[model samples]
Target chain A: MFLTVLSILGACLLIAQTTVLARMPPWLGNPDLLFLLVLFVAVKVDTFRGIILVMIYGLMMDIFSGFVPGLYPAVYLGLFLTIRYASRHVIVDEPVHLPPLAAASYLFCSGAIFLYMTIFNPGTDILWSWRDLLLQMFILAILALPSFHVLGRIAARIASNRRRIFSTAKGGNRFIS
Target chain B: MRKRSKRTRPIRQFLVISTCIVLFGVLALSFMGRKELTLPHRLIFDILGTAQSGVTGIINYVLDIRNDYIDLIGVKKENARLREEIKRHQALTVDYREALATNVRLRKLLDFKEQIPQPTITARIIGRDPSEWFKTFSIDRSSSDGVGKGMPVVTVEGVVGQILDGGNHRAKVLQAIDPNSAIEVLIQDTRTQGIIKGTGDSYRLHYVLRNNEINPGDLLITSGLGGVFPKGLPVGRVSSVVSKRRGMFLDIEVEPMVDFSKLENVIVIMKSNQLTE
Candidate 1:
């Protein structure tokens, strides 16, 4: 119960991050927190549960943010599944890897929409200037680093505290083994 | 009786499960498939409209209450704004009436089409495109309201521009100042034709031959050579005439009678004057 609560708390914090980023001045750029949340979940939870949580959060983000809907959901699911596979085969517990993963996921989400537009809505005038893309990348890099670091630390602390409390309260017999 | 109850258990469960399944199916299908495809989607639309109206009403009520409080506190800024808006609207109504009266008078005065035969649609300018070079503006009317790409838009006084791009209930009009804008204009008095081309900030009557004998104050209306704009609709007045002694063509600057900077309302010209009842 505590772990579930903590996971939800993490999700809410992610939402708050998105809201703050959105409210910031336009020069700051729109940094997506949905990726950070998915990455955190992938590291903290197992594959199946991670995917489910990320899917729900992705759907919520898609509904909240203004754009073609489902664009976030499909991209987030893919990100989660990849992270899960990486966690299974690799050491994702390290702190340094999370930021890069978050940044890459953010880029994927941003690029996916443009890719979809280019293919489906052909001949419709769309501008792809280099200056805009660079600005977006810089903003995403700045946002993803701090978010991943803080959220990763918070998730780790909560996980440890839950383990300690559960061990003490249940005499070490209540953990699902 | 015991055997009958045992047999009924699975059937009852099946009935309940089937009902739940159908409900979920309806909801999921409506949520996903119905939005982009066959379903009328009127429920979503109605809900949205109701929400918008609700918001507008709340805003109006709150603003009214706030203004009352502000008046009590000796801040009468809103009153000044209201008075300003009132004056502006008064000017607009007067101009509208005057233009309509002129159209009536002109139709009678001239032996041309006695009736204003073409149908018209009045749409509000809802948004401005961010691209400066495109010089595009969007209006509320769309294909559903008999509006299409290439339809000409104008104020009662003169031409505004042509609808360059369009969607279901939204469209972008390429303003007269756009580099790509072109129209066939005729001198209303002599009926001398010239190609009206945009010169960045305003349009100029181009390709007017040296011998056309054009002068300032010539009313250049749409020539109706292209089916897009109806002929005889006032475009602009010839502001300047450059008489080149040896040049092949003359440069005539037209002052667009419709002030694009202060465009408040516009009417879409639907078809030729002869076609409508």
Candidate 2:
């Protein structure tokens, strides 16, 4: 049930990203809300489910971005796996850990795209501006903590609800006993 | 425990191997150009694109409602003023009509069908390219309205861009100021020829001889050398020009006539036969 809700939410966010966010002022810069959601899924959800969700969202990103189809999937899935493996060794779910991870993931996704084009599609011209890059990173960093807090609260509620359902089912026979 | 572990191990291996194969397939498909979009690809675009169109419609409707309510405040005064202006313009239009009829007669004698620009279909911009470095956008015009790839899109002020990709109900346009865009142009005064390449918000006029009599505020128009854009269309105005003793060419920059940041409506030329030698 939760996964279904996430899927619907992901679809709505994807539509908003393509339509509404695309129209935002260029100087204000575009934020990757989907990436933040993926990060939340990575830290909170099961490994396999999170990886699959990230991959799907990444493909949806391609539709909005006008990029080639496979690039985001590969980058997003790679980030999910890396973050998931790192969680085993370190305390990755803490709020303090999310901003840097989100920033790094943004860089990794962008760098991989640049690297891919440089290596494979050299004929295409790519305009680069350091100012835009720095601005994007700064915006994402500022948004990270707030977005994480909001999503973390929602995830807590969902998890608690699931636990309550299971406990009630298991303890329902106490009156008969 | 041993039986369960054995069963799970092969399943995990199979899942991994299949996912790798699928990823490779997608990568290979990505390398293929946009022309190769298969049935499923088109279907996906059609479905998701409709959602984009719907969202844009809803937002535009709400904005329109707010604007209409605000506009109602001075409607009576504005209408009275416009009525007076229209009466004066209608009297002036009679003289303009006589001049226009004479101009058309003169053009017909000169075989003007090839000279006059053809009618165009207007398209509205619905979405922008999500990539920061790319200056492409999607338009509401589509193949059904005769919008085709490589067609020139323009505004009343100047050229806007060319269509890059088109679907039955939508099209993608690469803006004139994108780095990938290039046009053959000539300076109006001296007839100095150069290549106009997009450089972010402005344009760079390349290959101009260093000794040419170029200056700031010079007009650049499409030369129609490549048949991509019609001849004599306003491209940009020279914003700066620099020459060096060692180099054979001048470094020139141009300010595009159309303000892309404020672009809302554009007309796609249906057909243009105005080619020049």
Candidate 3:
């Protein structure tokens, strides 16, 4: 149920991103809500469920943007696994660490894509604008906390609802002594 | 560090093996270029494209209402200006009609062939590419509506793009401003041929020799050498011309005739043979 809800949410966010946010002024910079969702799943969800959700989001992104098929999935999964591994040793659960983490992850993914394109498709010209990159990084950092907060709340609600359903089922048991 | 249990070791191995397999699959797929849409990609397009179209419809409706309200604020001044502009255009139309008649007579005298109008379908812009790297957009029309891959999309202003891929009910357009896009164009006055390559927000006219007398504000029209776009369609106007000391070709920048960001509707010219793969 959590996966289902999150998937639907991700799809809706993608639609909005491509439709409405895409039409916004280029200078304002469209905030990557889906990237924030990926970060949330990486930090909050478990390995099995988180990886599945991340993969789904990445595939959805593949369908929407970029000519490369598997780039988003690889980048997303890499980020997820790295974060999962880093969280074990470091204190990253707090809100204070989210901005820098989001910023750094954004840079890593963008750099990875640039490297991939440069190596594989050298003929295609890719304009690397530092201004746009920094602006997007700043936007992601500012939006990271609130976007994660909302997703985290939704996840909590779903978990609590599952718990309540299980408790109610147990409470209503006629076979119990 | 604690030692792993015997049972957990196999599970860990399984996880590692699966991860490696997935990575390998991704690497293999990533290297491949754009191809026909798979079942999953098509399904996603059909589903998501419908939702995007519906949302865009609503947003456009609301925007229209907002624009109408805003227009009401300065109606009197705008109306007066429009009236004067219309009077001037009406006078210019007569001269244009006479010039057109003269051209027609000249064409008949020269035994010029009559150009048949290409079949076209209008498509509504549904969604745009989310990433800043690529300039692409999804349209409501698809293969069912005769919008096939490599169909040239245009507007009244000028050339828009070409159909990248088509699903059952939706297709994606690779905009002319995308880096991957290149169009064969000719300077209208000088007739010097060159390739116009997209540079994100604008186009760069490439391969024009330094000796070519290309100037800023010169119009560029499709040369029809590529067979993708029809001949004489307006592409852009040269915005700047710079002769660099290093290169043989003059650096030319162009401002596209079609405002891609403001485009809401486009016409796709259907061709029986797909010229581009």
lDDT of 1 by residue, A1-177 (tens): 534664576456555643344345545544445555666776777767777777777665543332234655676777777766777787775766655665565566556655765576454323344554566556555666576677667767877887888778556456666
Q: Which candidate tops TM-score?
A: 3
Candidate 3: list runs displaced more than 4 Å: A172-176, B1-116, B273-277
Q: Give the CAPRI rating of model 2.
A: acceptable
Give the poorly placed runs of model 2, Cα more than 4 Å off.
A1-4, A18-25, A85-90, A154-171, A174-177, B1-116, B271-277
- What's the DockQ of model 1? 0.01
Error of 2 at B248 (Å): 3.5
Clashing pairs in 2: none
lDDT per residue (tens digit) for residues A23-105 in model 2: 68878978767778888888788987887788787776665554355767777787788788899999887777777777777
Worst 10 residues of 2 chain A by lDDT: A60-69
How many residue pairs clash in each candidate at the backbone level? Answer: 0, 0, 0
Candidate order by decreasing lDDT: 3, 2, 1
lDDT of 1 by residue, B1-277 (tens): 9999999999999999999999999987768844363444677778888999999999999999999887777547767788999999999999999999767745433432333356777777664432112345668887777776677887667778887655687766777766467888899998998878665457788888878878788889999896778778888899999987888888789888776655545677666333233
Task: Tell me the tens digit of each residue's lDDT in model 2 across B88-156.
Answer: 999899989988975664444244234436656767788776666668888999877777888888876
**What does the i-RMS of model 3 come to?**
1.4
Prediction 1 TM-score vs. true: 0.39
> Model 3: what TM-score?
0.72
User: After superposing the true interface residues, what Cα RMSD does each candidate give?
Assistant: 10.4, 2.3, 1.4
